[model samples]
Target chain A: MSETRMPALSRRRVIVTAAQLGAASVASAFLARHAAATPESAKEWLGKLAKGEAKAGKVSIKAPEIAENGNNVPVTVAVESPMTAADYVKAVHVVADGNPNPGVASFFLTPACGKAEVQTRIRMATTQNIVAVAEMGDGSLWTATRQVKVTIGGCGG
Target chain B: MAADVKPRIKAPATAKKGETFEIKTLVTHEMESGQRKDADGKTIPRKIINAFHCKLNGREVFSAKIEPAVAANPYLSFFVRAEESGTYEFTWVDDDGSLYKAEHKIAVS
Candidate 1:
């Protein structure tokens, strides 16, 4: 039985790769068209935001490099701030590059929070980069990101 | 009540006045991606929790708008400073307009 399963598993892998390649090709074409209209590509939205157009520095995001479950992956963002009326963090946005929809969560924070920190779990259709963007009271933006690898066969996919 | 929805809160039930504390929360939800089909080959209507808000002493401290792409059983954690002892209220609103709420109190020593 083990010998018989080995060949089947290899065949399944080949099929999966072919399917993924096909999907990637389709996605590339779609992105090309979409990018023409939007200033930022879906996958590079964070990078665009980080190129001095938005304030940079003092934000950190923690996420797993590999997620065993794609349906629910944990994410956390923390910012260094006094959380005072004058210097508090304003908002934190979570974006998932390569998902059907990249924008995942946007958190609005007030000085009453006393600290700028948020943790949440988000879904990923496939392996992708998750970016966290934080807006500060001084009209500045900071960001951090990590890549998450998701297993493909689970969740009835 | 939806069989799939589950809610939990993690926070210290007691804290000293003027102390800062962290709060963690999670809810079990489908958070349908709106891009998939059900078993009947029909598009499953998107039902996701779009907003979460926490209020202490009738004052807002934290709020968030979640998108459909958020993972199932969403977990959110944040920090708050306890200036005075009062009830901390947490509410989660779904895209379908369903609301889930939880409350925690802090006793200042």
Candidate 2:
């Protein structure tokens, strides 16, 4: 399987290169069209209140590097929290950068939840970064991101 | 209408009085996004579990707003601090105002 895929990737690269040289090709056209399909930035889903303030820490995102099918990409997010009354995660948000809608899922939590972790499957239209944001009770935000490559578009289309 | 949408939940049976434990869930549903057509060539009305909430006794601890982009069999894993001995009630709300519920009991030792 590995040997068969190597040549296919290089061939795709060659075709992309040819298309990049002002040659009208179907592959480039599809690329351009599908690329535009992803309009909303992941930041837009993150909310304006957190701009330039969130840092990457105490968060772990689990997602596949290459998803053969984009229909059901299993993703998990875990954050470091004791789930104590005084120090806990208030909410968690998941976003996909390349999907038509960046917002994937939102989870709200309270101190009664002892741990800060969420797992779910999401639809991905293309290869893109999946982001997980955790908002702490102390008004601090943390994030983690992972890239997943999709071979087939998911979303039942 | 989606019927008998089975829900699976795993939570701690016992925990320290002030300790936190994990809750894992998998709710099976087709999550028909209303974009697809049926064999009769008519669009299938959207039916999905749009919201989920976990409560300890009468206190809400965790909740989620699910989206159409979420995949089928919506799997979720989360954590909650076990403050006292009580039953953790989980409810999944379907788009059509139906609810699926599951519960687990934990004893704070």
Candidate 3:
């Protein structure tokens, strides 16, 4: 499976590169148009907030490994920051990949927060990955992901 | 509008100067996600508190953009540094244009 997939992936990459070289502006515009679509997936949410990629560090999520009740799972997200006017966390976006809607919540913070941390209860449709992305005042994005097994799905499932 | 919605806040009344403290808040609301169906098989319209804001002495402290995935009776916990003596104002904006407000005073020694 790996051998067959490698060539196919490389071929697609070559095609993409060719297209980019042929019409770099058009390709970028097309990509931007698609990126503007209503984001419903966890990766899309990260892309939207992080502006493309996010590093997996300086942020952490605390939650149970297994949630007996999917209706209300307590989660906390914290980012390492001094909370000073010069350096602080701007916002943190929580996204549950397996939920009906990927976005759980977005917390906006300021230096007065003193700590770049937030706790909230979120609903998950099923067992899935909960991703927390933190946007720093310096425009850097950090992320953390945790998987939770839900015995029963939320949304009355 | 959400029925009997009330905002509850937990914050210290006093703190050492420049000390960090925790603040927990909960507002009662159904947070109907519009994905549920009633007994008659009709969709229950979505009604939720979409936004929450916290301010200290007329300056923004923290805020959140809530979504349907947030459970009913949304609860939030965060931290604030005691810079000075002031009132902390909390506000929740419901989908039906209802504003739920609460306040707590903190003294920085």
Candidate 4:
């Protein structure tokens, strides 16, 4: 009985050690904002800034369905705003659901741009939804989202 | 002085009148979030590029108010409809009172 218990105890120890190692590696990547790193973070950021009601319209986000590389993924966001002095897009926010940092970029625009559009490249940690929130000058909000599957090198080769 | 931060900007060399062109930009920054710790476990003060401004022909083309959530080495691409030939000026302001600037010329044909 004693001999059988020893083997079971050793196996359990090995499993615990391996689990700790994996967590340590991922922890290093997100040294700061450890608590904020989660799928809920993406929406929390939007809620903090936009608050209250947010509708999906006018905001269009363009991103690749399958990204060859997790790093430097190009994203474009466009809003159908007249971009006139009387009415225009005030700001736009980009969020990636699966990255260590969910909020990616925020763009501020003026009427002189002649169009309410922004394009930027971002990093993706894994397969997740990319959301965009557009704020119109009149205090209304619009949003759009797209899913992207990131493939690591060699695996897809 | 330039070693503090460098601004990289890409603008079209030439474009047809009324053509909407894209401008890509990036700045070298660590984007320290203050929540980080040093080797000694000391808290590092948060410093980031809080503002980005772009102007074409003395007109404000695109501008952004960067928040702390933005990733490091902020990269942004925006568009402006070409009305005339002029230079596009970019300015980035850091939280530590550091200012990085760059300019690109665009010829409107």
On TM-score, the candidate that comes out on top is 3
Sort candidate 2 into its docking category: medium
- Candidate 1: segments with Cα more than 4 A from true spot: A1-39, A43-52, A153-157, B1-6
TM per prediction: 0.79, 0.79, 0.84, 0.70
Each model's C-alpha lDDT? 0.77, 0.81, 0.87, 0.77
How much of the real interface does each model capture, measured as fnat? 0.87, 0.85, 0.88, 0.53
Model 2 residue pairs with clashes: A112-B81, A113-B80, A113-B81, A114-B80, A114-B81, A115-B79
Of the pair 3 and 4, which is ahead by DockQ?
A: 3
The model with the greater lDDT, 1 or 4, is 1
Per DockQ, the best of the predicted structures is 3
Per-residue CA lDDT of model 2 for A1-157, tens digit only, reads 5655544458788878777776656667556434533435678768742444678988899888899998899888989987777998988888887775677889998876667777888888789888888889898999888899999978653
**Candidate 1 lDDT by residue in tens digits, B56-84:** 88999999988876777778889998788
TM-score between model 3 and native: 0.84
What TM-score quantifies how close candidate 2 is to the native fold? 0.79
List candidate 4 stretches off by more than 4 Å.
A1-36, A152-157, B1-5, B13-19, B28-50, B56-59, B67-74, B83-87, B105-109
Rank by lDDT, highest first.
Answer: 3, 2, 1, 4
With candidate 4 superimposed using the best TM-score fit, by how many Å does residue A120's alpha carbon deviate from the native? 1.2
Residues A55-99 of candidate 1: C-alpha lDDT, one tens digit per residue: 446888788888888777878889999999989998887787767
lDDT (tens digit, per residue) of candidate 2 on B1-109: 5465888998879898777677889888888766456788787888888999988888898899897779888888887766789898889999989898889888998
